[model samples]
Target: MVTSSSLVYLIGLPLFGAVFLLLMGRKADKWGHLFATAMSAGSFVLGLLHFFAMTNRSEEERPITQTLFTWIEAGDFKVDAALLLDQLSICFVLLISGVGTLIHIYSISYMSHDENRRRFFAYLNLFVASMLLLVLGNSYLNLYVGWEGVGLASYLLIGFWNQKPAYATASKKAFVMNRVGDMGLTIAIMIAFATMGTVSFDGVKEAVDRVGTPTLTAMGIMLLVAAAGKSAQFPLQAWLGDAMAGPTPVSALIHAATMVTAGVYLIVRSNFVFDAAPTAQLLVVIVGAITLIFGAIIGMAKDDIKKALAASTMSQIGYMIVAAGLGPAGYAFAIMHLLTHGFFKAGMFLGAGSVMHGMNDEVNMRKYGGLRKMMPITFATFGLGYLAIIGVPPFAGFYSKDEIIATAFNSGGAQGIILGSVTLLGAVITAFYMTRVMVLTFSGKPRWDDGVHPHESPALMWLPMALLAIGSVTAGYLFTQGEALVHWLSPLFAKKGEYDELMPHSVVTVLAITAVIIGVTAALMKYQFKSVDSVVPTDVSLATRLARNDLGQDVVNEALFMRPGQALTEGIVAIDERVVDGAVRGIGAMTVGSGATLRRTQSGYVRSYAALILLGALVLLAGIWVVTQ
Candidate 1:
């Protein structure tokens, strides 16, 4: 591997922009947004240069690292403040910087009217810089810094309009839940250092096989916990829908395009550990499978456009997670889905923002209807994205998501059958909910409120959506052409030796396609052919109510964890105040009582001393006589 000093610029440029904007405060308001966009664009350009350089190098030398200093050192342990750029890291670099730049441009128009647009841009720059650090860090310890950085930035952006009490609460919910995941990562890193005696990627790779499966499994589970929080998988996914309380640009950049995929990246990066630990691998698959359906079911019942998309994001990330967990056969496909997902999902989010722009920031899809004629650019861009997400032919998701399903089936056992069925089920539900979004938002009769007028967004906003829409249509085909991405990433993974397929690839594709059609048809029959209620129906089934409330995830949490946690905390406080403190107070009272009894002996010392001396002399004479006898 080649060593270079230039990788720092990829993160530094954006970080500098953020610091500069924040330091200047109101003085930079006129220029901050533009400057932040330029910084992100510059990082993207730098990533391109490094990517080209990697392409020119021989396969074995494509990976490069830069060590700035020793970050930590103790007896028999060391970690460096360093950067890594290889086939895998390079993908994230481009995606974070490139898509991030587009979101910045979109925000330039989106948040122009807000009073704190300058600070908003600064947070955007900070977020991009932090995510770059996450992907570029050479060691897990170094990556933790970036991980926390991204979390902080997300909290800032999500609560940017913290004036609203609900928005503030939403941001806090996301922050606290993510910290739960971060603890898992912290433990995993400690395990690596304790067992393997190293925390760097190269070191971990070498030591994975040397360690036993139980240790690896433990490490893998911890890593999965981290991934679950960041990626919004089952049980840890409740914070995601509420996270849509953020601005649309933040949704596109942080939730859809970049930050949400951190888990998938983490899993793929730790392929060696998962490959060695079969039980851990199975657990990863289980989490993914459960979340895929969990998110899809919730998406089906959402009336808020952004929340619906957020649920879809959760489900898609599940697909990537399942692929990543399937060992070597899936590593590349998982990343492929992630990259393509970034393009389409970010574009669709931008499209949603444009619709909201025209409709006075209303988020309810139930209030929208026949907007296709009013917002042509949004309709076209969002339509492409919808097709891609539903696994339509010649679209991005088809190539990437299809391969994931095929790989799940190829695992070869009852496990394969269950997994493959679960993936196809997820696909069906995905199509239904996404199609439901389309029908309610852009199709059917006009249901908008009075005084509402819909129009296309300004060029500054739609232009980014346009660009991302193009990527949505083309990225998958490009990735799969001649197996391009798989080969590029193949060198990093242990060989995926030949294995028997439970079914033919063609058969799997057919099944996935058929499932999608059924879903689309089901949604259309209910929502398109039948009239949709302009107001959400209260007289619905128990299942619909459950889905509407995110499967009562919050209720479950309150019952299972939050309430119990609060009671436990109260009990601990009681013990400290009564049992622990009362004992100490009792000891203090006893000491005070003893001291009081002795105090009288010291009063009026002269007379008291004479009497005491006389008594002592008499006692001494008596003792001497007794001794003589």
Candidate 2:
């Protein structure tokens, strides 16, 4: 039987941990991280139990909701603070709590040396709690609360080392850019409420057919904007790379596994709206296509290991967004990829942290070479993640990513062909850049800086990496080999037979493999035996220069948004000072001057006061006599 209170514990445990840690302050420093890790593991355990309970029920009876209390009530409008546990949300819950548990464990060792480790664990608990809320909410308003909660948690974690100006700036940038998306979400919610008189998912789904197409289109586009901002899609993606300024476990948790996946979850959860608005769905495809390529190009030029991985994350998320836009045919696959990505990407990020721990916290790939011997466990685990991400057969990414590409081809028409080709090319580029990272960081002659020593990390760190690597290798096959995930997620999406393929699955698979081979071959040919310089050179080609500058995204943002915004702000300030404040000041000055004149007339002499009173009375009497005449 499905328990009503299970969902509450899923979200509540981590929050309890956070509050407990926060209340304990530094007093709990000795065991705070361990407590946080235990809380995360507990949430995951509850999630697993709940998942089994839901699976025992028939598909129609799978979705279970629990209403805690009324959150808002005004006239005809009302919303409940409720949680939904169904096929879709269940997937996300496991991913968040499961991967989050591992990240928390990794952070214990990764952040062992820091003075404020307790605070860091607290932030991790908060992040997990927020993400759980985001996916489990039964209503859009509830989702938004969780959404902003995740954003706030990310800012706190990203800027945890607030001593550095760059880290603080990155946190602020992430917050501001996400706000731009949050506004879109807010507008979408308002439109949903205004047009349909409901903000709950079930209510909207029931009412969507009756809503006008234009309104649906607007909702879809606005939702896409929100997704792009949170997921780091094109135009709003510049902040993600800089987010690497945080500790590596932060990168693993927030950027790789949890927070960045919020966008994909949002789109998938709102599939009913996008299914009705083809134009909006088309825009999602376009954004994904552009960003996948955009992220790949930037990834190719990045010298920092974390920045390269961050770029790869953008590209990979772009693929998932593309799948989500393909309508029902792609939602399940999008989620599958998202789950697998959480595994492999988090493993790789943690692997990067392990490398950094060994190498005096160096991030530049140029400073690393042939440390595979020095850190065998890290190398082995990172390689598995790398293979999975590159879509090699039998690895997790192969099943999920190849399915996306094949589904793209199945979209049919010139649009399908074009999108398919672009995605295929992205696969090639992904291989090249990811291979470059592995080869540079683990292969070739040692190019370490003088006197720098490298060694292995503690079991606390590598042990989690090993577990994630196992997932990276096996998750793909288990999910897709027999369309197991597709069937499992069927209740959330349309039937599989409804989608038609433009090409045979085998042909598409062959094409995808070929692309991977080409990319891997190109990377090996260029860097296999080559030694990299410890310092980056100032001189470069134009394309290289562009890549190094993130294709001038900052410049474009400044020119298109920042400068114009600054000018508008300056004008508003001027108007406020001269027009608004000036009017108030002028009125105040007049009142003060009139008071001064009246004061002069009221000179302390009793004769003067009496004379003024007589004059006033005489004038009043003369006016009264004239009126009477």
Candidate 3:
């Protein structure tokens, strides 16, 4: 049932679109967005067909590979430019193409007024193509190609508005931070090649038993570092907030749905390595736990709408990472959360864009209020996404997030207890911050600037928002109620004995619900009926100040990494100029001085040269005679 060309078209079409748009240039500006959207939608349709084809086959036959060509061959090392279609990859393909199509459609209207609309769509297509390659590639080397492709595309998209200095700076920041993580991935690949003698998933998985625990642990940790960077976990999380400087649609597509989730995919994709190393797995959980709290705390204090959403994204990804770190027991739930998150978060981001569109592109939430009446569609759609994210009952986030919490409690031991507690706290804070965003942006008195007029966005923008909102409401139930996603992903993980929950599922659900209610109530009390000041106050509590400054992450980076790095670079530069360059120059100077002195003996007349040669011979002969005597 699997068509050989299916995977090729799925990845190639978007790449073709990107190339086409780039070649067409400004001439296609009038319709390039439409062409890009069609290409993206086509890929999604292909993915759907592939999914159906996969479903028709038995579970054992679900995974199929399509080899385009042999990519590398050196000694015993061999690689194929191939794609693998399995439950795991199919899920990502759907998420990437599905959400990607919507983002593309939204961009059509969102970027209509811009002069560089064609270029933007081209970058978007490139991004989709890169992501497809990333998820579909069968080997680590192949994945690396896609990985760097993604980085390149993101750099272009994030800095698309390069005329703005801040946007350019943000793009550089994201690029640099990701490089820090990419190094980890690079090392991980090298280790895989060195230890396992193979870089393919199947090869590595099979070699796990033969490989030493230390080597596996090192590889696992390095992979986690890579995941943390791409996924914006912990130390690498700082760039994501600043990344909000890009256009809103870019935020929705790259930050909310596809690019930021790359880290989670990498970790889950390499679950085999993590399974062999408990220490590395524990570190994954620790990073996830810390980041969830870190992002939530920051979200609570952010006033910029996009920055707040970016923080929320960080927090949400942290939750997924936590689940991923739990080993096979939690991988399914982690992916489920990621899928559900793609929908809701993308919806929220697009909705924010809609709000910005109406508010004359204002990003500060403090300047927004009571526009729910004016922009009813944006309000309704955004509210659905907000509800889903807060884990309100029957919403998508409820099923995915609650399962993660339940699984954490069931993981057993002190680690479980601590992680469960952290998850619960994160849920509460998630609800609080999300509720705060909703109330400030839509519920209270209008705080609009004097010249600003609020109105609903065109159907092109709201339609995608509406569809994503619908996904946010229903995806969790469909994926979780029947253990559907878990079963679907079973082949990727080993069968383990099911553990009983420490508390009843019902009790845990209630506890989570209670936290949500408290968070909602707190936000409603503070903002629902009140008027907010647009100007941020300088005087604030210590905690508020810390959160406002992003927990001093930049300061920490400056002190611990940036300043030290700068000093080291300066030292190296000095050495290059003063010592290295000086020594080279000194040699040149000695050669020049010697040449000048030797040139004096090169007289125009042959007699002058002959006389000098005779004198030199006589001196040499005399020295030889004296030595003999």
TM-score of each: 0.94, 0.94, 0.94
* Pairs that clash in candidate 3: none
| Tens digits of per-residue lDDT for model 3, 376-485 | 99999999999999999899999999989988888899988999999999999999999999999998788889999999999999999999999999999999867989
Per-residue lDDT for 447 in model 3? Answer: 85
Q: Write down the RMSD of candidate 2 (Cα, Å).
A: 3.2
Query: Residue-wise lDDT of candidate 1 within 34-79, one digit each (tens)?
Result: 9999999999999999999999999999999999898888987888
RMSD of each: 2.8, 3.2, 3.3
**Residue 533 in model 3: lDDT:** 78
Candidate 1 off by > 4 Å: 581-629
lDDT of 2 by residue, 182-265 (tens): 998999999999999999998999999999989999999999999999999986898898888889999998998889989999
| Each model's lDDT | 0.95, 0.92, 0.92
Q: After superposition, how far is residue 406 of candidate 2 from its true place, in Å?
A: 0.5
Worst 10 residues of 3 by lDDT: 1-10
